[model samples]
Target: MNYRTNPKNGDKISQLGYGCMRFPSSATAGVSDIAEVKRLIKTAFDGGVNYFDTAFVYGDSEKVLGEVLEDLGIRDKILLSTKMPQFSCKSGADFETYFKKQLAALRVDYVDYLFIHNVSEKKRWDELKSWGILDWIQEKLDKGQAKNVGFSCHGSTSEFKAILDDHDWDFIMLQYNYLDENWQVGREGLKYAADKGVPVFIMEPVRGGLLADKLPPKAKTAFDNLPTKRSYASNAIRWVLDQPEVTMVLSGMSAFEQVTDNLTTASEINAGGLTDNERSAYVAAAAAIREFMDVYCTACGYCLPCPKGVSIPDCFYYYNLSFIDDMASVKRNFAGFVGNGNISACVGCKACERHCPQSISIAEKIAAARTRFGL
Candidate 1:
């Protein structure tokens, strides 16, 4: 696989890092299939993907990754990266508590990359600082428990800049995709971090599977007209890798096919790999997708576990899909997905909106879904 060197520490991170957030789940229940998870991880490792990213809040991701890598006896063969659930930290000691648990979960003594997760606002950063997060990180480094310290951001470009300037970050992660070139830290934040010699890792390169599947008809036509036919997913990923500043692109592959496709793309592509014609195709496809989208939700699921039991992301997904695909099929699937918690159950609590990184008017969107679907 193609690899890029992190300027800060000279670590050769794979161009395609395996994101462990969305492991395959059994159809009977939401439980992850451990055997399938192991197979996917083994495939990625055997394919030369060294970076495996997980987090505490990813619903047993860390534990499962730890178990799989250990069973495969390839923990040392890969770089283990995980995050501190900053939102769950109430005190300084909690940092150590959570980190120790992470280490234990991974069954590893040290992490290759440890990040303060989702440092989206200055207020959160300041709170973390007050809790002695910097010292805690230094302690981890000194003890060789964490090789690198960094953060993932989901805030305004100004807040992103402030956070970058506030600390000596070894790396930075952000939600970057062709559709979000001017959104949330965007190209400007990317360049800002790169200029300061900080390597950047990209998350949501496909906007949580939105770009890969459910393509707008116009967008699919744009790609279909291209001389070299590629999956919409490949186009989205290549668009990100076209930038020289991106150190790695993380894809949360839930299926074996996705793992295989991403591995091939990562191995063949390089910095500025896209040709002029290919770039034009992406530009056209992105425009069409944007024109077709109603909510712009990435389906990241951050605004989840709604107090009112509403499936906010599902509501938005079906609403958007209704426009691009057959409305009857979309509605049928939406019925099963929503089950008892339809959009009409929304109570206007605005709790989901508070956590949404996109700052989408989630309650308003739910209302729109009810109207569009005649729920």
Candidate 2:
């Protein structure tokens, strides 16, 4: 597999970092087939994936990863990364309490990379700082509880810049894809962090599987015309790898087939490997995908902090997906991911609309999404 060096300490991170959030059968039944999960992870590790990312809120993901790694006796063969649930913190002590629990769950003495989970806005970061998050991180680093510290963000470009400038972060993770090159902390943020000598790990390279499956006819046609044969998913991943600043691309593989396919793609592609024709094909495919989307929301959290707590962008994302994909899966994700911030919670307040850069009618779209999802 292709590997990139961590700019800070020169650790070799695989281009295909395994994301542990969507392990098969884990979310729907609240139970995982441990044997199957272990096989999938072992396949990935044997294929040279050294980075495994999970989080406290990912519902037993850390435990499953720990079990598989230990059972395989390859715990030291990979770099384990997980996040602190910043939203659950009420005091500085909560950090230690939750972290110790995570360590216990994972059965690991130290996390190779630890992040502040979902730091999506400046206000949230400010509150985390006030709650002594920096000190908590330093404490972990000092005591060897965490080897490196960073954050995953879904905030505006300005907020991302502010956070990147504020700290000497070891790395940063962002939602990046061909469809979201100009979206929240997009290519600009990727370059900004790289300029400051920070490595970037990308999540959602396929926009949560949208770019990989159920492609619009035109998009499929564009990819079909490519001289070289590749799956839509491979094109999506390679497109992200074309950007030299991306240090690793995380794929939350849910099945063994997915693991194998992604490993092959990762092994074949390298940074700046896309040719001019391949690049044009990607642009055409992206245009076709955009044509199918009903809303322009990129799921950036800029229009967040809605007084009514409506998950505006998330609702729009699933709503748009429902038109092009299976309604049942859309409903499941809306319920699973959106939670209490479902579109029905919108109070018709235009607070989010005023902040939206896309000029979308926030209330109108939420109402439409609510009706479409039957929420």
Candidate 3:
């Protein structure tokens, strides 16, 4: 497997990091199955994957990871990364409370990588400081409780730049995919971090399984003509790994089959792996997927003064879910989305569409969604 040097310590981190959020469910129906989770961990290690990522909010992931590591006696062999839930804390003292709890949950004395979970806006930055966030973190680093300090962001490029410029971070993580290269924290942010000599870790490389499935008919045809045998999921993964700046790409694999498939793909992937023809095919496929979009709102919130309590961007997101070639599980999410807001409330006002960057026919898209979903 390809490995990249951690900018701070020069440690060789695997390109494919295992995200433990997808571990098999236990009797709690959402909690991870300890035995199966351990097996998956062992399998990943055997396949040359050494970076494991988990978080406090990922459905008891820390506890499961701790149990599995202790049971298997391989905790030292793997690099453990987890996050602090700053949102759950009301005061600066609460930071230490949660940190101690997480250490016990993971049964680890120190974390190799620890991040302030999901800082997406300036408001969160204000909150972090008001609560002495940096001071508490510096204490952990000085005390050797955390090997590195980092953050995972789901904000815009401008906001991300502000964060990057504001701190002397060890590393930074962001959501990046072929589709999101120009979306949240786009290509500009990716390159900026790389230029600053910061190793970037990528999350949502598959766009939350959207690219893995729901390929447009034209896009599916592109994959079908490919000479190499691989799934749509691996294609998306390979695209991320092709970038030289990305230190590690995190994949949330849910089942044993998924875990096995991802491990195989990760070990086989290399930088500059895709040929010119294959690169063109993937780009063409992405364009075809974009054509299926009914609206171009961009979720910028420019037109938010709705007379009715309708969330336009969320409405569009759910609307897109219903148009998938095979509904399967997405249909349920679509149904729930409409139950929250109806298209009938749009009032046919041109105000929203006027400010839309993509110039999408907002009223038309909502009307279509209403009729199509039988809402």
Candidate 4:
């Protein structure tokens, strides 16, 4: 378990923090299997993992973590990181209400690292502040209920910059992976936060399981030629660790095998870990994957000022994924754009395509989305 110093508060954090979102299901239904969750956490701790990240909505994860850690008698041995759901702030008083509930759920009096959960859109933070939730958090911090204050963001770089300037945070979590280097905050946002002295913790280091599947036939040859040895997952994880701006990379491990595999890579690796040539192999591989996605849609939303309220980039992203690959994220991404005046509302207007520099033929893509996602 290699560790890095939190730039703001200087607390050492393990580079491979355990995310508790995907604990194995109990009935093979939806409920998380506590016994398996416990074993995985125990194995992680025994193997030197010290960061345990959970949230209120991860379906009994807080309770499972609390029980496991208490049974192991290692409450103080690891960092207890959880989030306060921003949407829970109905009033200033609800802050304490929700925070206390989280404490009870986790069976802990104080959280080592607490964040404003999932600040994906700029409106999320604003809505919370309108209800005085930020003030409530500060009060809790002053009262020692939360040791460190921060947020986990999925918003754009500009929004993240504003949030960094708006508050003094001990750490910040962002969705960073090999594929998303140019996505939100991408490389620039990461450096911006690091320069401001905020320790950056990374989530979704593998693009939410997009990189772990059997390599495409074209790319398998390149991976097979590697010298030192690596799996597709290991190489992807190593790429994130290679970046200097990232303090820790969080992996949501549901299986003991995953825990074992990740621990081996994380324990042996460090900053400046990958060689120049090896790094090139990964970059080349990622390029090949992008070559599979020839759309060149940066997802910049330049085509979004759609008059018909259609989600243009979103429609294309899902359409491509559903037809071209079996990745689960495609369906997940599609679901979000289904309601409202989404792709189904395209109305065959080529106005958006006219504005698109990529000349993507927006109406055609929307028709494709209708067929692909059953819209």
Candidate 5:
């Protein structure tokens, strides 16, 4: 697999890191198909994928991943990363309690990389600091419990910048993909991180499998008509790898075919390695994807500062994502904006609609977002 050097510590991380959140589910809820999970991880391990990421919030995946790596005798062969649910931490002692639980579940005394999971607001980071999370993190590093420390952000660009600057992180993770190039940190945030010598690990590189498998017919045709053939997954993945600022792209591979396909692309694609035709195909496909959205909202801040605090662009972003991703996962992630930006906050005053360049029915779409995301 292709590897990139971590700017903070010089560790060689696989360009294609394994995301354990989407492990194939079994008949029982919250339980993954362990046997199939083993096969998939084994295939990836054999194919030279060394970076494995899981999280405390991903149900039973830590234990399952721990079992798979232990049985295969490859625990030490990979760069293991698991997230700590820092939002739930209220007291100083809660930090160690959660960290130990994750370590025990993963069957590892220490993780190669440890992240503060899903920081979505500056207030949340501030609360964690008040609760002594910084001291706890330093303890983990000093005691050799976590080799590298950082955070995975699901907040706005401004929030991302604030949190990134607040810590001397060994690495940071962001949700990035071809379709999501302007969301969250986007390309500019990646560049910002690079400027400070921070290594960036990308999550949602395929937009929750939307860009990979659920492309609109027009976008699919655009990719299929390319002179060089590639899967829907390959085109989206390679596009993210095209930027040198991206240190790694994490793929949650649930199938054997996915493992092999991702391995092939990881081994071949490098920074700025996409050819002219592939680049053209990306533009064509992106335009088609945008054309399929319910609203023509280009996520320009034109409709910002809504009277009711509605995140117009964000609401529509996830609203468009609803057409592609699974409803369950969409709702869960969309829950982050519950009180602040969730479309339920909209008062339908036409305040934002007046400034919309696309003249979209802002109230109507916000209502749809509210219902679609189960707000």
Candidate 6:
């Protein structure tokens, strides 16, 4: 795999880092099977992926990753990253509380990379300060509990820039895919980070797999017409890697096939390597995506387990699909998510919105699905 230098420490991070959240779920248990996860991780690591990112809130992700890395005896050979779940921190002690828990879950005393979890706005950062955010980070740095510090962004460009300039961060992770080039801490924030010499690691490089699966007809056609014919995921990933400002991309590969696909894209597609036709195709597909997108959701599943077990992401997915695809086909697949008593489970609670990186009005969209498809 290709590598990029971490501006702060000169670490040669793999260009295609593994995001450890979406491990292939077991058909019976719904959580990732330990054996399968180990195999998938081993494949990626053997393929030259040295960076793996996990988070405390990503449902047993830290435990599963720690187990796989330890079992493989490759923990020392990789760059390990995890988050602090700051949204749950209310005081200085809470910081220590969560960090201790994360280290325990990860089965490591120190992390190569640590983050403030999801700092979307300056207001949140300000609150973190009142709770002693800076002092805690410095302690970790001085004591060797963390080697590098950064944050993941999911806010407006203004909020992103505010936090970025507020401190000398080693790096920052942002959502960058073909569909989000001009949205959410878009290219403008990316350029700002590049100018500051803060390496920008990318998340959601394929829009949570939406670019690969649910493209509108026009968007699919635009990509389908290309002579080279790569998967929608590869085309989207290549577009992000083509930008010189991107330091690396974190693909949450759930299966072995995805690991191989990403590895091929990483080794072959270099910066500024996209052909003019491919570039134009990205332009055309992006426009079509925007024109037909109903709810601006990435299906990240952060807004999940709705107090009532309402499947929030699936609701938006089918709701959006109804518009661009055949109604009969949409309804057939959507039958499991809605067209029953499921959509009615959403109790108009706004809890999902708080965690949604895309800031979708989830309850409102769920309501729309109820009215339009919950027959």
TM-score for each of the candidates: 0.97, 0.85, 0.83, 0.79, 0.81, 0.97
Alpha carbon lDDT of each predicted model: 0.90, 0.85, 0.80, 0.77, 0.84, 0.88
The candidate, 1 or 3, that scores higher on TM-score is 1
Prediction 1 global C-alpha lDDT: 0.90
Clashes of 5: 0
- Please identify model 1 stretches exceeding 4 Å from their true place: none
The numbered model that scores best in lDDT is 1
lDDT tens per residue, model 6, 316-345: 888888888888788888885454567777
Flag regions of model 4 displaced more than 4 Å.
293-370, 373-375
Error of 3 at 360 (Å): 15
Candidate 5, residues 141-170, lDDT tens digits: the string is 999999999998766778889999998988
- For model 6 the TM-score comes to 0.97
Measured by TM-score, the strongest candidate is 1
Model 1 / residue 48 / CA error / Å: 0.8
Q: Candidate 3: where are CA atoms >4 Å away?
A: 294-321, 324-371
- Give the per-residue lDDT of model 3 (tens digit) for 44-141: 88888889998887778899899988988888888899988776788999889988999999999999999888776767777888889889989999
Give the clashing residue pairs of candidate 6, or none. none
Candidate 2 backbone clash number: 0
Tens-place lDDT digits, model 4, residues 160-273: 888777767788888777677877767788889888888899887765455665345445555667787766777778888877888989988888888898998898788788
94-185: candidate 2 lDDT, tens digit per residue: 88899998998899999999998878778878888898988989999999999999999877789999988888899999989988898889
Q: Positional deviation of 79 in candidate 5, in angstroms?
A: 0.7
Candidate 6 wrong stretches, greater than 4 Å: 337-339
**Candidate 1 structure quality by residue, lDDT tens digits, 270-344:** 997888888787789889888768898988888888988787887887899988888888888988877535687
RMSD after Cα superposition, model 6: 1.4
